[model samples]
Target chain A: MKCGLVAADGAVLHRETRPTPRVVVDARGGGRAVLEALLETVVELGQKAAADGHRVRAVGVVVPGIINAESGIVSAENLAWAGTPVLAELKAAIGDQHVILAHDVRAGGYAELRQGALIGTTNSLFLPLGTGIAAAMVVDGSLVSGDGYAGELGHTRFVNGEAAELCACGQWGCLETVASAAALARRYGVRSGRVVDGAREVLELLAQGDPDAEAVWKEALAALVDALVMYTTLVAPTRIAIGGGLVGAGETLLAPLREGVAARLTFQRKPEIVAAVLGEEAGCLGAALMAWDSITDESGEQTV
Target chain B: MKCGLVAADGAVLHRETRPTPRVVVDARGGGRAVLEALLETVVELGQKAAADGHRVRAVGVVVPGIINAESGIVSAENLAWAGTPVLAELKAAIGDQHVILAHDVRAGGYAELRQGALIGTTNSLFLPLGTGIAAAMVVDGSLVSGDGYAGELGHTRFVNGEAAELCACGQWGCLETVASAAALARRYGVRSGRVVDGAREVLELLAQGDPDAEAVWKEALAALVDALVMYTTLVAPTRIAIGGGLVGAGETLLAPLREGVAARLTFQRKPEIVAAVLGEEAGCLGAALMAWDSITDESGEQTV
Candidate 1:
C-alpha cells in the first residue's frame, strides 16, 4: 500500500510504502483483515503527521477496485473486497477529517491531468498497461467516473478469430487478454517453453532477437493499437498517456502504436501518443490532491 | 429542415419544415446555397414568431455534422458544409436574438434526458440507428461533445473476419456498415437479389419469414449486440434508448438486442434497452430547451 501526506501546493510532505495484508480469501470474511490494515495505516499516518509538527486536514484513499462514491462501498476481486464499507471505517479510524475515496487509476489520471503528461489538454486518456489494464478517461475537462464503472477499456474486445484468448473478466478476446504486461510474459513463456521473470525479461529477450519474445511483443502491440483506435473512434481524445509497466519499454511500445493507429485512422482526429510522467507515485499524489480540492471546494479558497 | 417555435415551458407554439435547396456539391462553393437556404429559414421563422404575438428572444439550430462550438463552424458531408460558419450566418440573419447551435443527435438526447425516456437517469445512451448511425452519450449527467467528435459508436469496428465490409468512414466492418437502416435495405437487396423500399420493407419481409431478410436482420442484431456490450463494458450506462427509423420495427429490433446483450454480459452492468419516446421531434425540442437554458443560466432565472 502506498500512502503519503501531500500539501495543498502539490508538495509531498511525507511518503512511505506499507505491505498490504494477505489472507486466505474465502467465505469466512477474510477481507476484514485487509480492511483493518487499511484503517490502521490511516490512523498511524495521522499520528505521524502530528508528531512531525504538521496538521492533517484531510485524507484521500485510492484503491484498485470499483468504488461507489454514494455509499462508500468498494468491490475488488484481488483484495477479496465485495461491497466493503471502506469510507465509514476510515472515518471512524480518523475522526473529524474530510475523507475522499477514489479508484487508483482515476486518481493517477487526475494527477496526470493536473501536473503531468496530460496537462493543458481537455479530452485525453490515461491508459495504464500493468498486470491488468484499465483507462482513466478525461472527457471535456473532467475525469469520467460513470459512477465508478467507466474506463474499463482493457475488458473491451480487441482480439478475434482462433487467436482469441479467454479474459479473466469472463469476456472472450478482451484487450487485456492479449496486451497486458502479465499476458506478454505468460505468452512468451508458453510460446518458447521457457519461463521469463516478467515482461521485463520478455523485453530483454526481444532486445537480443529472441523469436518467441518478438512474437509475444508483436501480439501485444497489435492488440494495443486496436484498442487505441477503438477508443479514438468512440471518444475522440486529444492525447493519450500510456503508463504502467509496459511503458518502461519506452519507444519500443509507443513507436509501433503511433504508426499502427495513424495507419488505421481515416476521418478521426489524431491524438498525441505519449508516456505518463508521474510513474507509480501518481495514485498516492492524486489522492492527496483530491483531498486538498475537497477542502478548497467547500471553503472556496484557492489553495493550489 | 424541421423548425419550431417552442415556448419556455416546453410547448410547441408553431412548427414547420422547409425543403433544403438542392445544389450540385462539386466545385465553386455549392455549399454556399445550402447555407443561404438555412439563413433564410431562420430569418422567416423569427418574422413569423414576431407576427404571431410572440417575442423571439432566442433561436436554436441543430444539424447533422461535426460542430466546432468554439468557432461555430460546421462540417456535414451530406450538406456539403466543410468548415462553414453556420453560427455566424445564423447570428447575422436573425439580428440580435441569441442563437444556440448544436448537434442534432446530442440535441435529441438532451430532450430525452429532460422530458422523455431517459429522464431521471444520469448515465445513458441515445442511439439512433438511422440511414447513417451516430450516438448521443450522456456520461456522468452531461452530454459528451468531445469537441463534436464523440459518440461515433456506429463507426467503431464490430463486424470482423470475411464478412467485414468497407465502411464509408474508410474503416472495415464498422457497426454502421451492418446495423444502420440504410445498411439493412442495401444488404437485403444484395442477399435476396430484390430491391426494397427501405428498412421498413425489410422488417415486413422478416415478419413473413423471408430467409434473406431474416439473415440480414440477424446479422444486424449480432453486430448491435456486440457494440452494446462493448459500450456497457466501457461506459456503464444504466439505460439505452434506441431511436431513428430502425426503431420503427419496435420489438423486432429491441427484443433481440436485449436478449443478446444479456446473454453476452458477465461481469459488466447490464443496461435496460428501450425505444426512444420523442421520435422525430426530439432534436427540435432539445434545441429549444438548450436555448432557454442558456438564457436562464446567464440571468439566474428558474424558467423550467
Candidate 2:
C-alpha cells in the first residue's frame, strides 16, 4: 500500500509504503482483516501527520474496484470485498474529517490533469499498462466516473479470431489479455518456454533482439494500437498519457502506438501520445489532491 | 432539412421540411451556395415564427459535421464544407438572437433525454442506424460533444480478418460498413446478385425468409452486437435507445441486439435496449430543447 501526506500547496510532506495483507477468501470474515488494516493505516498516517506538526484536514482513499456512489459500498476482487460499507467504516474510524473515496486510476488521471502530463488537455486519457489495465478518461474538461463503472477500456475487445486469448475477467480477446504488463510477461514465458523477470526482462530481451520477446512485444503493441485507435475514433481525445510499468519501455512502446494509430485514422482527431510524469506516485498524489479539492469546495474556494 | 419553432413551454408552434441543396464540390462557390441556402432557411424560419405572432427567442442549428467550438467553423463532408464559418454566418443571417450550433445526433439525444425514450436516465446512449451511423453519448448526466468530434462509434472496427469490408470512411471493417442502413441494402444486393430498393425492401425480404437478406441482416446484427457490447464495456450506460429508419423494423431489429449483447456481456453493466420514440423529428425537437436550455441557463432557471 502506498500512502502519503500532501500539503495544501501540492507538496509531499511525507511518504511511506507498507505490505498489504494477503486476502484469505475462503475463511470467514477474511475481507474484514483487509478493511481493518486499511483503517489502521489511515489512523497511523493521521497520527504521523500530527507528530510532523501538520494538521490533517481530510482523507482520500483510492481503490481498484467498483464504488457505489449512493450506497457507499465497494466490491473489489483483489480485496475479497463484496458490497462492503467501506465509506461508512472509514467515517466511523476517523471522526468528522472529510473522507473522499475514488477509483485509483481516475484519481491518478486527476493528478495528471492538475499538475502532471495531462495538465492542459481537456479531452484526454490516462491509460496505465499495469498488471491489469484500466483507463481514466477526461471528456469535455471533467473526469468521467460513470458511477464508478466507466473507463474499462482494458476490458474492451481488441483481439479477435483464433489468435485471441481468454482474459482473467472471463472475456476473450480483451485488450488486457494481450497488452497488460502481466500479459506481456506471461505471453513471453509461454512463447519462449522460459520465464523471465517480468516485462522488464522482456523489454531487455527486445532491446537485445530476441525473437520470442519480439513476437510477444509485437502482439501487445498490435492490441494496444487497436485499442487506442478504437478509443480515438469513438471519443476523439486530443491527448493520451501512457503510464505504469510498460511505459518504462519509453519510445519502444509509444512510437509504434503513435505510428499505428496515425495509419489507421482517416478523419478522426489525432492524439498526442506521451509518457506520464508522476510515475507510481500518481495515485497517492491524486488522492491528496481530491481530498484537498473536497475541503476547498466546502469553503467555496477554487482548487487548482 | 427539418426545421421547427418551439414555444418556451416545449410546445411545437410550427414545423417544416425542405430539400437540401446538392453541393458541386469541384465547382467554385458550390459550398458557398449551400451556406447561403442554410442562412436563407434560418431567416425565413424566423420570419415564419414572426408571422405566426410568436417571437423567435433563439435559433438552434444542428448539423452533421465537426464544429470547432473555438472558431465556430464547421467541416461536414456531405455539405462540401471545410472550416466554413457556419456559426458566424448564422449569426449574420439572424440579427442578434441567440444562435447556438450543435451536432444533429447529439441534439436528437438531448430530445430523447428530455422528452423521449431516455428521460430519467443519466448515463445512456442514443445510437441511430441511418444511412451512416454515429452515436450521441450521454455520460454522467450530460451529452458529450468532444468539440463535435465525439461519438463516431460507427467508424470503429468491428468485423476483422479476411471478411472485413472497406468503409466509406477509409477504414476496414467499421461498424458502419456492416450495420448501417446503406450497408444493409448494399450487402444484400451483393449477396443476392440483385439490387434491392432499399433497406426497407431487404427487411421485407427477411420477413419472407430470403437467404441473402437473412445473411446480410445477420451480419448487421452481429456487428451491432459487437458495437453495443464495446460501448457498454467502456461507457457503462444503463440504457440505450436505437433510432433511425431501420428501427421501423422494430422487434426484428431490437430483440436480437438485446439477446446478443446480454449473451456477450460478462462483468459490464447490461443496458436496456429499446426503440427510440419521436422518430425523425427527434433532431428538430432536440435543437429546440438546446436553444431553450441556453436561454434558461442565462436566466438561472432549470431546464427539464
Write one digit per residue (lDDT tens) for candidate 1, span B128-197: 9999889999999999999999998989998777889999989999999999999999999999999999
* Candidate 1 backbone collisions, by pair: none
Where in model 2 is the C-alpha error above 4 Å? A297-304, B297-304
lDDT of 1: 0.89
Q: For model 1 chain A, where is the 10-residue window of minimal lDDT?
A: A295-304
In model 1, where do residues sit more than 4 Å from their true spots? A297-304, B297-304
Q: State the lDDT of candidate 1 residue by residue for A1-304, as single tens digits.
A: 9988777788887889999887667754678888998999999988888888777877899998899987889999888898899999988888878899999999999999999999999899999999999999999999999899999999998887788899988889998988888999989989999998999999999999999998989988988888898899889999999999999999999999999999999888899999999999899988988888777554322111
Deviation (Å) of B43 in candidate 2: 0.7
**Candidate 2 residue lDDT tens string, B215-302:** 9999999999999999999999999999998999999999999999999998787899999997999998898889888885444221
